[model samples]
Structure formats: structure tokens, C-alpha cells
Target: MKFATAAAMLAAVLGSPVAAQNFTSAAEVRPILDMTRGSWVAIREYGGKDLVYFTHLLAWRCGLREIRYGFNGAAPNTPFKMEQCHDGAAQPNAISGDGVFVSQPGGSVKEVRVKLIYDDGTTDEARFTRDQILMR
Candidate 1:
């Protein structure tokens, strides 16, 4: 208990930065992410593993420095891996794009969101509420 108390007190003294990130539209994000498009899929295992929904994209853009998944607007500096893509420069990008806030098959009680930060100091945030993946 002493250790826990000490940790808590130390944390209180050294306050952490707010995890808030700017939420933006897909069009603004796509250009920065270098992605043609992006969407939120709940439990839709791409590589396997049933976590929460993931923010997937079409034609992953290069120079994607970081991707952060935040629940209810808190961007907890979690580690994430962007999908590997090859030679995506040839593909065209979208300016006015649209996506549905799909309530995936298994619904989540809280809202979900993702932030994409590029190597050029650009950041975009997409918000969604998780739904269960429609398993086949």
C-alpha cells in the first residue's frame, strides 16, 4: 500500500498532459495520413485477436508517423502499428469524403476515436462509437 500511495502522490505532483487531440474530417485526415480512405470496424479481426474496433483505411499513405486510438476523447499515448503498404503514391486521393458511424454488430457503451499524426507535423482525428463486428 505504501508503494501504491507513493506512486499516486508522485503522479499527482507531476501532472500529466491532457490527452485531447483535434478531431477533423476524413478528407483533411486522408491527405495527411496518405490514406485514400479510412473507417472504424469493431472486432473485425484483420490479423486476428478480439480487441475493440479498429480504424482501418484504404491504400495506406506513407510517412504515417503515428496512429492513436482514443476512447471518449482521451488520446493515451498508446503504441500502434500502421498497415504496411507499398508504392501508394500512384493512387489518387479524395477531397470530399464521407464515412458512416457504423454501430458495429457488437456495440460499445463508450465512444471511440482515432488520431493520425504524420511525419510533416499534421494530425487528424476521427471519432466513432464501437459496434460488434458482424462475424460470419
Candidate 2:
């Protein structure tokens, strides 16, 4: 019982940063557009496993020197990769643009770490655990 309690406490401490990620909530991202909706509006899973959808263009316009991500517990070193962002004009069902960032890792992905490095010496980051990715 004591060991279990201690382990739970440690898990809570380690998971706290995930709660502080810059990921915009679904409620907060909904007001950005009156008629259009897309994955960029919030953090989400796309396609299948090892893939996550998020936004990097709303607040800072992604005006950063570099954006990188890594899988599991590895240090973030992979360059950011995302599809082009377009409005709902062309495809009413889907919207794309810089307003979103999608990472499609090549293999089984249990966790993801993303780091956004801005030119102003500031950074925004997030990590998606497997449970969070699948549950959401």
C-alpha cells in the first residue's frame, strides 16, 4: 500500500507538465472561426497511431527558428513536419494551413515531445502520452 501511494504521487508529479502544455483546449479554439472547423483548432489524433494533430500558427504564427519533435522519452531533434493549411472555402469539411502542426512518426509511438523555438528566445512545448493520444 505504501509503495503504491508513493508511485501514484511520483506519477502525478511527472505528469504535471503535460497539463501545462501550450495546447489550446477545444473550447478555446472553437471561436476562431464561425463556419470552419479543423484539427488545428485543438490537439487531436489523426489517421492512426504515431500521428497527432495540433496547431502552431494561431498565436505566434509559428514565427520560430525551428520546430522539432521526438518519440517516447528521446530528446526532440526531428524537424517539424506538417501539411499545408487551407481555409474551408475549398473543402468545407476540412481546413488546413499553418494553423496546424501534424507529426506522423514512422513507427510505433507511445509518447511524443514537441518543442517550438521562437526567434525571441521563447519556446512553447507539449508532450502527448499514449493514453492521451488514444483517449482523445
Candidate 3:
């Protein structure tokens, strides 16, 4: 199916009005390169809970053509992963993704790096800090 048509269907499913031609480029995957150049890790540890929270940070501005992201966990990490991403055009500004990190003994997450590549050939990066991740 064509991307434009798929996007329209997605918009309908999301219950939001997505402008036509929002995603100009084809849904074709781009090449992977130096992700470290424009990316930061977003992770936080909470005591001996044996769980670490990690996520991908997106800018408030919409118009993102594509997004390429990956994760790098700190030491003592375990494999208890649950990941999700939000890149809906209907809510472009709210684009984001997050997952769980399990650590042994300490239950700490040192960091989670994220890189976002927009449709306009631009990039944005962010790392989640303890203060920002803590719930009120």
C-alpha cells in the first residue's frame, strides 16, 4: 500500500485529521550511520526495584519524516525489556518511545541514548535525567 494512503488510514484510526502529503518521502528505510553524533541516552534508576525506565525523546515541533533510534544500557543490566514508540502523524508533537530496564543488585539505569531524524533532514537528541523522570 502507498504511504500516503497508509498515513490517511492511520490518521483515521487515530481519530485525528492529518493533512495530506504530510510525509513526502517514501516509507523507504534510510541508511544507518554515526548515531552518536546527534543522540543522547534517556534513562533513570530507582533503587533496588530491579527496573530501569528508558525512552526516546522527541521535539515539540512536528514534520518529522523519519526516526531512527536505538538503546545502550549500562552495566549490570538484565533482559526484561518492554519497548514502545509513538510516531503518529496525528499527534506529531507528542512523538516518543519508552521501555523498561532491569538491573541486577542495584536496579540502576545509567543512561539511554536517543536520536531522532526528521523528514527535513534535521536531528534532535535528549537524555532523561533523574529529576525529569521522577514522578511528582
Candidate 4:
């Protein structure tokens, strides 16, 4: 009887939904980073927090850059502006851009999609299932 009870209890714990929702490992996030190598992204507030959504063209690179914020979908009335930031050397870098992403609590790496608009009025958007993004 003791053995049977212990087995049942262990099985229940292992099958719980909390266990099912376990976070992704770094290996799982590698593909996302590869996909985001050079893509545009948009930053937006989700659930009272900022999240990044990927666009088609915006990409991560080092150098001079500019970006502008705009709205799409149901809420097109709001407008936002972008500022430039130098390479972490100063308040502003030549490549200043914003990104909207969804992340797990406590900085655990997770997947997110983003949309971005460039200063030249071009746009890039894409989706990532397990992409890792660092919050600002």
C-alpha cells in the first residue's frame, strides 16, 4: 500500500499543469536568436508592461540609426517617437531603436514576435516562437 500511494503521488506531481508549463532552455532559444539577427521590431505595452513585436526589415546591428513609432490595427490614433543611442558609451547611440516583446517573469528567456519601423519609413515584421529579448 505504501509503494502504491507513493507512486500515485509522484505521478500526480509530474503531470501537473505547472510542470507542463516549464520554461524553455537556452538550446530552445538559439533558433530564435538566429532568426532575429537582422529584423525590425516594435515596442508596445502589454499587460501593463513593455513587449516587443518583430517587423520584416528592422535588424540588430552596430552603427548609426533612427526609428519612429506608429500604430496599426484597431488603435491607429496614438503616435510615438524614437530616439538615437550610441554604443552604450553615452546616453544616446547612433543606432537608437525600440522593440516590443513578450517575456517571462524574472528575466527568464522566452519567445516573442516584434514589428519595427525605420526612419526611412520602411517596416520589417516577423514572429519568433522562443526568441530571447533583453528588456530596457
- Clash number by candidate, in order: 6, 4, 7, 34
Off by over 4 Å in 2: 1-49, 56-59, 82-107
Q: Which numbered prediction scores highest in TM-score against the true structure?
A: 2
Ranking by lDDT: 2, 1, 3, 4
Candidate 3 weakest ten by summed lDDT: 26-35
Per-residue lDDT of model 3, residues 7-122, tens digit only: 67656554555554233232221111222232222333346443433222223223334444333343222322323223454643343444323343442433443445555586
Residue pairs with backbone overlap in model 2: 85-96, 85-97, 86-96, 86-97
User: All candidates' lDDT scores?
Assistant: 0.43, 0.46, 0.38, 0.35
Instruction: State, as a TM-score between 0 and 1, how close model 1 is to the true structure.
Output: 0.42
Candidate 2 lDDT, 52-127, residue by residue in tens: 5445233422234556777779877887654432333333223345434455543466777766555455655666
lDDT of model 1 at position 29: 35
| Model 2 alpha-carbon miss at residue 34, Å | 24
Better of 1 and 2 by TM-score: 2
Clashing pairs in 3: 40-113, 40-114, 41-112, 41-113, 42-112, 42-128, 65-119
lDDT of candidate 2? 0.46
Model 1 agreement with the true structure over 1-136: per-residue lDDT tens digits: 9867644543443353212212133333344343322343344423343345344442233445566665555663553544443443333322223331223233332555666666567776666543423334
